[model samples]
Target: MVGLYAALELAPEDEIRLLNIPLKRQTEDIACELQVVKLRDNPKYIALSYTWGSPTSLNNEEGAEDISSKPSRLILCKAKSNSPAEPQPLWYRIMVTENLYTFLLKARDDESHALDFYWIDTICINQKDSEERTRQVNMMAAIYQSADIVHAWLGEEDKDTGMTFQLIRALASCCTGNERHKRIEGLKDITPKALGTRELTAKLGACADISNWKSMAMLFHRRYFTRAWTIQEITLAKKMLALCGSHTIDWEDIVKVSEFLTVTSWTRWISEVTGSHQANHAVPNILDANKTSGNILYSLIRSRRFMSGDPRDKVYALLGVAGDSVRGKSRLTPVYGKRSVAETYTLAAIQILEDSDDLLLLSCAEGDSFHTLPSLPSWVPDWSCSRALGLGVTGYRRYSAAATIPRTLEINESDRCLTVKGFRLDDIVSVGENKQDILSGKPFPNWLLIINAMPPIYYTGQSRFEVFWRTLITDTAGTPPCHPAPHSYRPAYVSWITSKLSACVNETAQQTGDSTFINALGALAATEIPGSPLSSNRPLSSHDNERPGDSKNSIDLDEYETTFSHARHLRLFLTSRRYLGVGSESLLEHDSIWIIPGSRVPLILREVNPSAFRVVGGAYVHGFMKGEALESNPLFRDITII
Candidate 1:
């Protein structure tokens, strides 16, 4: 007892007492029970020797209803074992609360190995409460900011003397016996104050030949990335690349990407090998083959498809083809631990094809009763093509316009629903055959959009569409809209006429003059189709005596219904946007797609592109819209085919 206090400071006037518990008793039964009993004695704080099962019992008290809910602190032991050289199994409950890590270790000098350590964070913290955890993260920087000294127990317990000497010798070949002893001396006196010199610490930690740099960086990245390495890591990795110099050819220009680095001597060493594994049926060592395969896959992602022609390319291609199988067998785990290479590739391809609007066009011939949408070329299969590209379907799939006949428009004033007079849309396609082979019963593969009464521009949020019509007398595909603002461009005048008629229809229903609606409809019909009979040659202003009931409120309904039908067919010949999912920049970036089989796949707003569709003939993706006629584009797209 006198030896224990010999080196430790003790207040001269204060009394010191020692109450050592019996070592032979089970740790949980006696030591832990005594800990609770002593804590209940109203002591300010307690330092418990965490022998064997003591940590488990103490951690259990964290959530126990019987214990005090006040902030209780425990002084944990940091000492290692005394005699046994080999690391043994141990158990101690650890808590990961806020940003503070707390753990209990046995404070014993025993050589025999009866107790084990348990390293668990959940059991140590009250994880059931989020507020408590958030409070913990906010406290981390403060608690660690002012520590005077920190210790590193590099030497294992019961190890032979001069162990650190042996470690230095094995690490560096040129080390002499004197230098080895000097290194050991350095380790013995290392302190937090000495490591406070940021420059010296970084150089010491970043010995490239040393594998332990990663471990050292891990200890510091969380704190230092926001502090020192915010500038350091980026600078260091950049310098490393510069040391290798640049190549005349870009990585994407390389053919046979796997061999381009190793077999060809066109460039210096570009990257350091982290680790490797072998591939199936590979002639090269499994480790080397795996390295090549990874390199090939990464190159393809960077759009270096031309460079990946080696045997390793075959492995990578097959990995894409048999994506799930390869993923199931691979050792790599995604950060989220769920996404696979196939899914990643599909997502990237979807991104590239959807960004450009030029790839979305197709030829369509419109007639009185039917329209035909032309087929996209081999390059235009949309999202489905990415999965089976250069294989399976050598040509694009085509879909003919599902013929629709215009019927008398019927109005129901009581309800907003408008009925297509004498026409049923049910038999538009041969259900069983088309459903099985062509349409696949997937709306994303069909080229028709059934829109409500709103103008497409108000719903799409595309600035160009809203500005197109005021300038062009002809309504061409991909033309801009009509607007008078600074950035505005005009669209076809006929579009304005149609919109005016639609507005009148809405106004008439809301108790406005029915004659106004009728006159607007007649004006639009007569202008768009010259020499057309509008059922009335006179404007509603002249027909002021006519009953408001006879004024056609249904006129706007018929116009919208016909326009929507034509737009549906036009989608088959044009590329439409499809939602890809939430983006990395979004607040809900990592939100998983809650998908059921045969249900619509949600797309991200920016990731929506026309090329994501695979249909027989032509298809496109449409940006998301509400069921109402006039609405804003939903941030995400609801994928509709065609």
Candidate 2:
């Protein structure tokens, strides 16, 4: 562990020397390159970290002359992937191990058989150097992907009890269905020969078939999952239901998750463990809340990008592919005759996500305070989230201008909103006004911000009169009477569809009547209260707190430690570029401010004309009381405190 810590300290700026040879050449090379010898002649410390399999082979005396040249502290040990077996190896107790990428210390020099110490990989690898870490990351896929056994080290006694054990046991139990210890204890109830056969059978199955896939899956699940996942798990469950084409789950497990949700942290592990188990099962009868949470959890596991510590491009890819499948599934509903359940859950997911947006934003906001956790782009958060751009200019070319802006707006964060001044032909023409009068004045609501941008009519060159099936299985029926229309047939369809959606969505909101959204919105407002009045909300100003050593141009781990350490201390979630923005793959720096929840950023407004005023960015205003007085700053005067 000490060596690993030293490696962490030394690896940031220097390439590690593996010290593979019989002498101390690797260590000497490392010292020479770093100029530590010149800076502090005969530097006091030399720590030796070795692999467990190679411990006996290291001849400590071979490099005595080399070691004699410097004032040194030597700590040596071999790395072990798992606990030692009988003869007790070192101390009678088992040694603890961490994830493969990093190593942890498990024993001291006083212990026999065990070397003075062992260097855990993760701690030893210089995490600060993305270039160096990249090598480790690239190898991670194989490490976890092909591993035979993955062990989790739950910390000391009382701290190890309750949730920690529950989580560990839950994961392990997912594969074995019971603790190995208990299973072994129960074995005494049976004949020894029967147990031997059982063990043999298990081993054969594990090696030949997918006997232990669940455990591997669990390990991978924990490695990638970094936060509370009740919400994500629920989301995944719903998706799995869609995958299975069902709206039901095992009754027993659903009750378990429900129970967990209502309990305190001490018992919360019940929900966390069960949630993963149930999601793995893909139960549908689960509530929208639980389903959403499950889906998010599932996404993290099945997600290659997140697990491998890469950005969310793979997430986008996965979603895009799923969207295609969803469309296909929607089309197949009529034939398979499962439209009701599929549509029900689909609508449920939409409603649930919409309802939870505030909560999600709030959770993410609080977790990500000080801009540590990267957030999903505004569009990514809600697949159905849509915004319309308003074109304000009018009468440039009435008939021709209509071609410029479509009624439907597709999802894009940076340019979702529309503006009038800079763009050509902004407004719809008045029906009765003469060409001259129509051109004379701007419309009252010059900039129309479409609250719920309706989906565009899908076109594959079909005639307008042709009846194409839509996923809105609940709405369609015999054609309702319509006014004979020569001038606006298309406009009429667009308006009708939009009105139906708008009314239905609004109706659903009134029905459920949940206030979680408002609460989440309040949370979001808390984060922005700190920075709003100090400066303008421009994209560039986001990373104001980042130091000079850390910039967009370079990847530095010290910056990461500084930033995440602060975030972890503050109990806020920290994220990086993967959650937002485009460019290089790196975590978001401290100075990089994510003041507003991306989902709430309203894309259409961002595209407002570059000429009149560009909303470079924005934030919520809250925390302070409306009339409370405060010392004057550059942005506001007589600010009130909450």
Candidate 3:
């Protein structure tokens, strides 16, 4: 660390450094040689894809290098001495995290992996030199894509790893091999709803093992899947295989299983088994990620951070995979020290809006109005926080709130406000419980309270009670996940709600592996609210006698819960005009909903002053979703949101 080393300066713009592993090394000697390679020469090497774990804090008793992990071991790096005139090769002792050290040891002993040279970010990149870091980051995509093999280290295996890996192989096989599954897979929208009641139950059973659902859930519990950098690292890799201790699994199999779980909504059951909301959440993120083809918006949505302590990385980390982020094309150039996080986030929001040519990014700002960075404008999203967009905003569902009119959207970076032209749709008068209530079957009462306050008739004179079920699912249903609601959902909704009101959640959840429904509906039977409609006096619907084990009833609960779970952490709201909708958990009583032009769904905006405002988040209002509020000669105001 002293005069023994200078810097790992990658002198040439096109040249890079690699850690050279000697074929035979002294067991006691930890020194590894360094090799410089030119991209033109096309050398063979493997890169590492992993998450930088929690750092050791100042209060940590370990007293070790605290950047990525707690325990770090000394590694000798071959470097040049400080003297320029007579540069001598010196063995410099450096520290690598215990995790990385273990990975290196595994790589060394791995007879299957024969590449001698390796490219690891922490050792290969000059982190202390900001200029060099920027240069290297620009080449990260090319580095991963050009690598002969990219080995993803999923950290040392745990007790569940064996069972999870076995389940992963089985589920991955079922997705591709099972003939019964293949019939449903052949349909354009391969969802559980696409199958008949018998097929749905049979399909759930036909998988190699549904009993190992907990193990499958534990696989996603790995921190490696949540890091922002993992998206680009695994996405751009030419050939990738995940390594966990002694076991190695193809990355494609993991992707296939995750995507399969997503379409079928089987991932929701993981929450019941693992009792971890994180595992419940992670599988769908894999659904959002496409291996080789994805756009900037999709890349941004999938890049959830693992708190690397740098907010700017939430945007910078995904630049490599953002199709629009090519050098000259993207306004989002990855700058290190030049800009603040506020400036970076503002710049990124502007860049994405202009590049994406829509207001979709505005919908992604899901945190509470309390801006993490005080300087960050309300219109500018704090990418540091991870949040999912509204269900209506997903590619699977289509809703055009503004007709075919060209957008009059403008970004006023000088004042940090977005000027958009559209009419105010409604004001959120009452807000209900969010997705968290579903696990306890308690969301029903407060949501029912909000819906009950409104008139029985909808704006179009349709039954508000009927529309309530449609609004719960954003009015999209069918055999496919994204189809229009068939007449069946109405009766199905009756059966779904009555089943919850009549039955006991603890007993039913154990029988059906459905704690979420019990959580949502259990409150009605369990709690006695004074004016709650479904209190003791109200008779259970016609389906009360049908047990959850009944095939017909089980299929309906599966379909409804599966559909509702996809849109997580949303709160039901009643607008001032009696319109019902589900919005971001951040939605409040006084927040106004606006139908901004060129936006697929309406957005919640909190007024800061008279005309200026702050974007709350996206919403799925019942009546105005399909441009019903847009009149031919409707006046559009230029509202500015800071």
Best by the lDDT measure: 3
Report the lDDT of model 2 for residue 116.
Answer: 22
Runs in model 2 with CA error above 4 Å? 1-120, 123-130, 159-607, 610-642
> Which whole-number lDDT from 0 to 100 does residue 229 have in model 2?
19
If scored against the real structure, what TM-score would every candidate get?
0.18, 0.24, 0.82
What ranking of all candidate models by lDDT puts the best one first? 3, 2, 1
- On TM-score, the stronger of 1 and 3 is 3
Model 2 per-residue lDDT tens digits across residues 1-642: 334324224333222322111223344221111111111222222222112221112122211122112223223333321334523211111122222112122222113313221112333344445555544433322222222222222112222123322332332222322321232222222221222355534543322122232222232232122211121222322122100011122323333332222221211122233333112221111223232332331232222112111222222222322322333233222121223332322332333243332212211211111222233222222211111001100111111211222222222223332222112111111111111111122121111111111112112232211111111111111112111111122223333333333343444356567635433332232222222222225342232232222323331222121111111111111122111111011112232222222122111112222232222111111111111112222121111100
**Candidate 3 regions with alpha-carbon error over 4 angstroms:** 1-8, 54-71, 79-88, 177-211, 279-288, 291-294, 305-307, 324-326, 329-331, 367-370, 395-397, 477-480, 486-492, 499-554
> Which candidate, 1 or 2, has the higher TM-score?
2
| Alpha-carbon RMSD, each predicted model | 28.6, 26.1, 7.1
lDDT, each prediction: 0.22, 0.23, 0.65
| RMSD, candidate 2, Å | 26.1
